[model samples]
Target chain A: MAEYAAQGKLPEVLFFVGCAGSFDDRAKKITKAFVKLLNKANIDFAVLGTEESCNGDPAKRAGNEFLFQMQAMTNIEVLNGYGIKKIVTTCPHCFNTIGNEYPELGGKYEVMHHTQFLKSLLKEGRLKVEGGKFKGKKITFHDPCYLGRANGEYEAPRNLLEKLEVELVEMKRNKSNGMCCGAGGAQMFKDAEPGDKEINVARTEQAQETSAEIIATGCPFCMVMMTDGVKAKNAEENLQVMDIAEMIASADDL
Target chain B: MQYIPNILFIIALAAGIGYFTFNIRKIIRNIKLGQKVDASDHKSQRWSNVFRIALGQSKMVVRPIPGLLHIFVYVGFVIINIEVLEIIIDGIFGTHRVLSTVLPTGLYNFLIASFEILAFLVLVGVILFWTRRNIQKLKRFWAREMKGWPKNDGNIILYFEMVLMILFLTMNAADQSLQSLGVAHYVEAGSFPISQFIVPFFDGLSEGTLMVIERSAWWLHILGILAFLNYLYFSKHLHILLAFPNVYFGRVVPQGKFKNLASVTAEVKMMMDPDADPFAAPDEDATEAPAKFGASDVMDLSTTQLLGAYTCTECGRCTSVCPANMTGKLLSPRKIMMDTRDRLEEVGRNIDKNGEFKPDDKQLLNDYILPEELWACTTCNACVEACPVSIEPMSIIMDMRQYLVMEQSAAPQELNTAMTNIENNGAPWPYNQQDRLNWMDEN
Candidate 1:
């Protein structure tokens, strides 16, 4: 972004690699895979680097409105400073916050989840994807709450997956009825409250019911939780958890 | 002596309606105890929701079986209630079949015939509903929050519908018999497609006995409806009256958008301004009293939420779909709404007894809804979406969470750490902001 500013040129999009995409070892792979696709598409994009901040989803959900507003205001200033008009994120948390919750605080931008962005890129003939290793492999897509029920974008990720020609087996719970991976509402930051079963474990058993080879997800949070779920069930030997971006990148050999 | 029954009928009608009006006022006052919110936006969309979700029962039909049955009872019951107007006028003026005298026989007979058909359909719907609740024992009805009065209240409502429909049919059967007997007041008015089958039950009866049966059925049917109307305040059946308004005020924006607090936004703006004085005295007139951040009690919640609580049919659709409850967590969205309305009613009684609310060492938070239930929610909006009437149980859960975190400063230790991480590292985890671009490296 700084280099682009120096050149007095605007990038086509600003990639918001949220916290998990930046720090979590597993989610970083999704970030890298998406970036590879962005490069392949030949679209100029910039990252805010250190200037980016949390969009306050976790704090607001956890009920710390004060901290959430501080973070929201500071980030709004940075976003408005760069005059960022468009954003793409690998995390539904950031995608939802920036698009739905930021306008009242003056941080308004056109935001898209990476799956939606990738689908659009494919639509415009900017990106090409073909099933290489993933052809005819059984898979199930988990709906992220923020992306699916919350924002009513249940089909974008599935639209991207359809391009791979994978045999998509749906869990009993999918779409608006899709069960949460249990890491939302800042649950990712906290231990599970006392319960008969961990939410991820329950959600994982539903995925296992379909006997799909891969459990595909779009959000970074769902990625972490579902990966942990697959491990918990000792199905890592049979089942794989992959993000839609990672699946696309590997399929196209990007 | 001839005018005595008319006088008694008038007295019963006035008493029934008057008491219902009194209770309705109390319910409105209790709901008004909650805090106010702006439900004035998206006028067209709100009305559209009223049509789609409430009037149309669009969300209900997602399950198909119960949804369709409910629509049967809903449409049948409402359309059938048109006959109640005739009953009311007849009871008052001491006239029999007044509407039949006014309208062309074809339209009048059509209306009566349709009402008879609806009455029979409502009977079938009620019987199936009762079986589903009592015999099949749906898991939602047997949930922990539904054990006591709620369970009985549900069955009682079914019984009420069953009895009313029977009385309606019986009344028609007696009227049909009198018409066959060439009785003058009964007059060949209205069709009896359903009740015609019941006329045989009066085979052994004489003129006096048939008249007695007809008069009793007429009186009991109207009075039974009045009893059901009053019973609504104490039953989950209040949705019959309140679902319309509740759906209209439902969240119009995308469900993911939690509200931004204007009060907090203003303070943050002041803090971020570089030219602001740190030592300056606050403007007394400009600044209002510091408001409590979140809800620990029913009064702190929005009136729309309170209205939602009253509007809850306790169908338990929200709880059944809730991931937290499905996994055996303590949380139940149905319980959340029930507790809110219960606590609000308690507060209303307190005000009624002694001028205003006197704190009773208990509140909606710890007393009615436990923090464990509040913490169990993942805020997935499943309950909100599953609700047939657009009741937002998640909003109430989040508000209680806000109360715990902001006012009580009693957030879970792990959550506190997450908030701190956001404070220091601009993320929920302990990642260095400088490393945010580390993923960009080819390695």
Candidate 2:
């Protein structure tokens, strides 16, 4: 972004790598895969690169208004300073916050989840998705709460998956009625209260009911939770949880 | 002497309607006790919701069996009430079969037959509903929050409908019998498609006896309806009246967007603005009342939220779909809404007793909805989506959590730590902000 500013050349999009995308070891792969797809498509995108900060989703969702505002204001100032116009990210939390909540605080941008952005690119013929080795594989897509129910974008990820020519099965609870992955509302940071069973386990069992070899999801939070769920059931040997970007980037792999 | 029944019907009618109006006003007053919010925007969208969700019952049909049965009861409830107008007119004017004289006999018969069929369907619907609650004993109906009054309230409302339908049919049967008897006041009014089955039950009764059965059933049926109207104030059956308006004012924005606290935003801006002087004195006349961060009691919640509480049918659709509740967590979104309503009513009573809210030590937070229950929410929006009436339990949970974090400084320890980390490191985790770009360096 700094180099682009020096050249006075605006990138087509800003890849807003969120906290999990930047720091979490597993989520970093999703960020990398998304970046590779961008490069492969030859899209001019820039990262804020040490200038970006937290988007205040966790704090806001957790009820710390003071802390949330402080974080939001800081990020808004940075995004506004660059006159950022468009954003794409792998994290639904960031995608949701920056897209829906930031306009009130003076940071306005055309924000899209990676899946939506990728879908638009495919529509524009900039990206061509091939079935390749992933053809005919049984896969189920988990709808992230923020992207699906919160923002009503259930089709973008599923639409992209349809290009894989895979046998796309659905859990009984899908679309608007989809179950939660249990890591939302800052639950990823805190221990869950006592319960008979974990939410992720329940949702994962639903996915397994379809006998899908892979549980494909778009959000980093769902990735972590669903992975843990597969492990909980000792089904790791048979089941795999991969992000949408990870699946697309590794379409040739089994 | 014939006017005595007319006089008694008028008195009962006035008392029933008069008390219902009084109670409705009290409810309006109680709802206004909450913080005011502008629901005046989004007229078209809100109207669309009123039609699609409230009028059409689109969301109700998600669980097809109960949904369809509910439509039977709901549509039947609305359409069958048209007969109440005729009953009122007849009761007031001492006119028998007045509608039969006004409309074409065919049209009147059609309407009457339609009402009778609807009445029968409503009876069947309520019976099935009772079975689902008592016989089938669905898990949602038997949830922890549904043990006592809620349980009986469910049964009582069903019984109210069942009895009303039976009375309607019986009244029709007796009236049709007198029409056959060539009685003077009978006037040959309605087509008795459903009540014809019950007509033979009065096989040998004379004119006086038949009139007695007819008048008694007429009085009980109308009186029962009036009583049911008043009973709505106390029962979850309030949904019958309030669902329309509650859904009209439901959350219109995206589910993920939590409204920022403007008061907190003002302070945050001052802190962020480098040009502002640190030593500047605060404005004296800005306001004297301390800024409350989020909802601690019913008074702090928005009127829409309070309206939502009263609108909840206790259908448990929200609770059944809730991730936290399904996982056996202490949280039940239905319980949150119900608890808010209970606290709000309590506040209403306090205000009524003392002419103003004299702070009861009990509040919605700890007194009704436990912190544990609030914390269990994953904020997944399942409950919000599952609501047939557009009631938002998640927003209430978020607002109470805001009160917990901002007003009381009492969020769970890990959450506080996450907030602190975001403050220091610009991330919820304890990672350096410089490392935000470190992943880009990886070969």
Candidate 3:
């Protein structure tokens, strides 16, 4: 946001590279994939760069409302100062909190999850997926709780995946009744509570039951949990967990 | 000598109403133990919500079979109370068939016949409910959380209804026999469509014997109703009275919308102002703001949340759908509401014992609801969606989490690390702020 302000002009949209996208070794691949796609589509976008901070979704979900507010206020100040309006994020958690929770704190803006933004780009003919390498692979989409149930968005990611021309199998509990990947509400920051089986394990099992070669998700958090579940089940070699952006980026040869 | 019956009737009436009033006072007092909240917004919408959810049983019917069965009990309980009003009048004035005198014979018969049909249906519903709980053993009712008091409380209410319905039919049968005998004051009233089947069982009884049976059944029926009324405070049956107000005052916004704290918003607004001094000294008047960030005990929660606790029916619908609970986690949304009510009751008792709540060292947070359980919650709002009374268990969980994170700084180690990363690097990762753009350089 600060970088754009210094240029005396605004980009078409602010790309909110969330914490995981910015730093996590695995998530950084997704970030690169999405950024390459944006570049190939010739869409004008700018990153917050060093000026960006956590969207505070994890803090808020973990019950640290004060920390969440502090982080949110800082981000809102920078965005408002830059006169930023449209924001597109690769993380559903960021999309959910910024789109839904920020307005109450007086930071209102049009925020779109990356899947929706990508779908819009496709609709506008700015991007195209030719299924270069993923033509006939069996793929299944895992619904992130925030994107699917919390925010009523189950189609954008799936629609993007459909462009890949994959089999696109679905788990039993899909759409509004989609099971959580067990990392929501800040559970990613803590050990699993006492239970007979981990929620991610159960969710991964459901995905595996679909016999899909790849489990596609829209959120970085879902990717992490689902990946861990696949690894725990010793099925990592056969089943790969991926973000919709990564698949689309690969298929489009970005 | 004639005044004896009227005098006895007045005494029974006073005792029943008097005890019921006392219990109502206790409930109000206990609920008042929590903090106040302004749920007075959206008047027209709230009214419609009450009508649709409480009166219409809209949410209840989502499960079809059980939902329809519950509607039978709910509708039966409500319509049958009209008969209770007539009983109250009779108990107070010693009137026999006063409603019969007021209405034409046909209308009176129609009303009696409808009540009889409802009574029979209510009996069938109650019996089916009992079988579902005990015999069929629905997994929800048999969940680990439904042990002890919750289990017994459910069964006891079903039994109470069965007994009440039986007494109602028995009283009607005795009255039918006495009316046939042309007994004075028996007053050939009431179309005993349901109880007429019971008339055969009382065939050999003498007129005097039938009179004793009728009067005893009448007394028992009224007394049983009073007992049931009082028992509501202790059992989950309190939902019968509270579901209306709870649904009416439920959150009007979408499930995902979390309201920002007003004080935090104000502080943020001031900080965003370019002209405002960054290092301005804190205003003395602003010190009056609450010292804590979120709820730790009953007194910290809003009155609507407290009312939600009291209104819980202990039907494990919330827990059954909860992702954490379904995955075998310790979190149960139903238990969260139960713990809140238990803590609120404890606080009320403390106030009663010591004139003010003395610090009990125990709070709704760690003492009753373990942090493990709270942490296990995915905040999916399944519990709120499944609740028939519109209770939002997620609100309480969020409030307590705020307390844990802000007041005590007692968040899990991983969260602390993530929060620290956000503070230093502008994100939840350990990478430096300057490195955030590195992803853009990749590939």
Q: Which stretches of candidate 2 lie over 4 Å from their true place?
A: A252-254
**TM-scores of the models, in the given order?**
0.98, 0.99, 0.89
- Candidate 3: TM-score of chain A is 0.97
lDDT of every model, 2 decimals: 0.92, 0.92, 0.86
What CAPRI-style quality would you assign to candidate 2? high
By summed lDDT, the worst window of 10 consecutive residues in model 3 chain B runs over B263-272
Residue B400 Cα positional deviation in candidate 2, in Å, after optimal superposition? 0.8
Tens digit per residue, CA lDDT, model 1, B1-443: 88887898899989988999998999999899888878878999999999999999999998998998898899998898789989988988889989999999999999999999988888888999999998999999999999989999999999999999999999999999999999888889998899999999899799899999999999889999999999998788899999999999998999999988788888899999998898989786876678888899999999999999999989999999888898899999999999998999999899999989999888999999999999999999999999999999999989989989999999999999999999999988888888888777746
Q: Give the candidate order by descending TM-score.
A: 2, 1, 3
TM-score winner between candidates 1 and 3: 1
Across A165-237, the per-residue lDDT of candidate 3 in tens digits comes to 8888989878766788988887887788889999899999999999999999988888899999999999988
In terms of lDDT, the poorest run of 10 residues in model 3 chain A is A1-10
DockQ, model 2, C-alpha based:
0.88
lDDT of 1 at A212: 99
Put down candidate 2 lDDT per residue, B365-404, tens digits, no spaces. Answer: 8889999998898888999999999999999999999999
Worst 10 residues of 2 chain B by lDDT: B281-290
Cα deviation of B442, candidate 1, in Å: 5.6
Q: RMSD of each candidate?
A: 1.2, 1.1, 3.4
Q: What docking grade applies to model 3?
A: medium
